[model samples]
Target: MKVQQLQNAVEAFDFDINSDEHIPELGRLIADKQVVFVKQKLTEERHYDILDSWGSPGMSPVIAGIGLGKLKGLHWNAVRNTTARIGKLIDPRHRSRMQSVTFQKDHKGRALGIFTNGKLGWHSDQPSFESAQRVVGLASVEASEGSQTTFLSTAECYDNLNCEDRSQVDELMCVNRWDMISKNVFDHFAGELIEEQHAIMRYNGCPLDGLTAPLKGQTASGVPGIHFPGSLFGYFLGMSVDESKKYIKHIWSLMDKPEYIYTHNWKDGEVCYMDQAITLHARPTSVDEGDMRRMWRCSGYLDKLYPGQGPMTMKINVEGEEITWDELFKRVDEVRKAEYNRTKWSKIFHKMP
Candidate 1:
């Protein structure tokens, strides 16, 4: 398999999983390019094999209970399942993770699932999770015309800033929060089931006051890059929400330049991997309703780098009291059970017709 550089941001090659050097070389290329693409589609076994080669696959905090049994992995099945069924199938314990990405619409033109038909704002996958996957892989099962995935190099974004701007943000920390109860569509259909069912859990709750690292940090290979979390960012420590917005906008202005971005129009049978820590990716609004687009995503932890570490501590507020994360989740679960018992028959009755 010949390896070639694509747009300076991604390295592309046809994968050969059996070659002794391929796996190591793949690792090296990912470190250098921040993203890599394989032109060939992989079988299910090969797909999992490639991911295992990196590290233990990270459990998705969004799609909860559907597991690969002893295989210990998860799959996002947007193309094959209906929106309501997908919503009903998700394990409430993992409801906070972003739901499926799709532009599918019903005959009436209403959005059919968790994601809207509009463009997804820029983000790295689940940056707020304490066990956030260090590497993410997506394999295309189908492709849509006029739909493209864009990527920005945070390290490149950081380097382009003036020295003073760099110094100002280098020591700062961003307080990231995603109120699963507020931002997600699960509750819209299921009615706070996740929150009520104690599914309002995250690996780590919000960052503690005054605890933060640079918005720019060193990559696994010791390369400095921006770690902007985009929409997941709530506010920067030591700055008011307004101040944080202005600061973030200023940083985005520098990073948004054309030369810093790479856009890929995916084709069927292609797979892409990205170093989630140092990059931000987005999808433009896909307007073609007749087109079918599908991709399978999997995540893996950074456990190899930090051995024997357990789940990070989390915190949350319950009725204005700051409580332990576990305590809060217990309350949510209790609420869910109560709500489920109250509505179970009604839900079944609604479907009976």
Candidate 2:
């Protein structure tokens, strides 16, 4: 195995994924570098194996059905055309589970065929959940030109903050609400919210009430950093929403410093792994419809480092009996089919203004 620094804080390695030492060595590298980039083409089985070695495989409520014929994990089919339509037409409750990021356009040069809006705001993955993801891995199957992913280390950002600022933020907790942050995006695509379908679209049993998480959390190696993700909807628990926005914006200014940021231009066969809990990432809106940008993404938790916080567990009332996570999914799948069958054409056409 050969390892080298891709940037000041990101490392790139040429190592055998099947080797016995791969997991420990990669874990150490992830500790030292907030993100690690490796150049290798991994098969689906190998991909899941690497993710499983890190922690329990995370299941996205949105992509649960996508993995029907595949393995039993959160598998996202993030093709450009499919994701674009799903983002707009799918119910918000279900849309949240569709967490793949893509920027694809059609031959007409219009933005109608992409899932996430261009230039996704800087954010860590799933901060609204009680147990935010710790590690995220993305492998490029097809690379897009003029597209880059930018990352900022929250640990580094926190270190750069003045002592007084750090002290104030350290004492606070932030409320993360998926609905508030995503409201405009969803509204832009899906029009007004569908009140009746709201309850069915939840992901991993996370409540719509939102999560109250500490502003600072420790990495696996005990490095402390800001844990809040970049979303318009969060607020410092005791502060007014406006006050929280001002404070978060101040932090964003600090993080925007060039020294704390790294940009990676995607190359096919490259796999990038990030410690999502301590890092924020964003992508520019550069892909046109003809651009071929496809990536396979997998994320997992590091329970030992940030334990008792994630792998959200919830009990669902199923015919008067509480069911487990697996059982609940089965019930959800059945309901999803019924709903789709009932409103297939209307849901698709209703998104058109």
Candidate 3:
């Protein structure tokens, strides 16, 4: 296996990803470099295998469990069987959200994947919530031409800051909300707020008010870096509305530097892993030939990292009360169950095999 440096990423060529001996080295590369690309073909099951080796599978509620049916307005058990009917359920791990980003639709004209045709803004998955994934991996499946996934490492951006800006960033707090996130991050994109998307978020238990620290741990390395969720940003904590706007502009100007950015034009069968704590990514263009392109995505914490060093450890507040990450998810699960029973889709779908 050989490795080379891209502008702000590390590319591993001829690497034996399936070999157990190489897993530790690959884990190190992902931790230190924050972004690593391996040019190799991977099936959906294999994609989950690599991520699972690192830690727990970071399942997005919207894409997993009860939220899956809720998001599509279908019955949960029905969707599960529909997924299985299309193909055999090869493994139990497949039950976790191994999201496919595609425009293709099923026979009933339902989209086969999420974010089928849109320009995704600068953001991290689950940015507003404290339960952000530690690492995210994407495997290119088919026809990924004319599209690019761009990434920016806040760790690099933080290192570039002057002492004054760095100090201010450390002391500052950021407020993130689902309601105003689209307007702040995707001002240029049409239809900023998709109501169905927000409804799914609510069903999955994402809070409206998410309090975050501007500077937090970047990776398992435990180095401090800016946690800049530009998309989900509502305002800085304890700042006036007007003052927050001005301050955000100033902060973004510093973090969104050209030197810290890397844009990848994907090739088929390639996989990219990103350390979520330190980085922000975006799909810079809308899918014109959406049916032709597909990618598999999974995110979760890395096992190689020290315990308590993951995103779940971040100090975050919901509403006004501070709670443990597990506690938050438990509460959300309860709400999801209530909605599932209330909707009666549970009965319809679960009644099937």
Name the best candidate (by lDDT).
3
lDDT of 2 by residue, 178-233 (tens): 45656664343222323322232234222333446667766666677887645534
Q: What TM-score, computed on C-alpha atoms, does each candidate reach? A: 0.66, 0.67, 0.80
TM-score of 1: 0.66
Model 3 compared with the native: what TM-score?
Answer: 0.80
Worst 10 residues of 1 by lDDT: 70-79
Q: Which pairs clash inside model 1? A: 154-226, 155-225, 196-332, 196-336, 197-333, 198-332, 198-333
Give each model's whole-structure lDDT. Answer: 0.54, 0.57, 0.66
Model 3, residue 260: what's the lDDT?
Answer: 82
Q: What is the lDDT of residue 228 in candidate 3?
A: 72
- On TM-score, the candidate that comes out on top is 3
Query: Backbone clashes in each candidate structure, one number apiece?
Result: 7, 6, 1
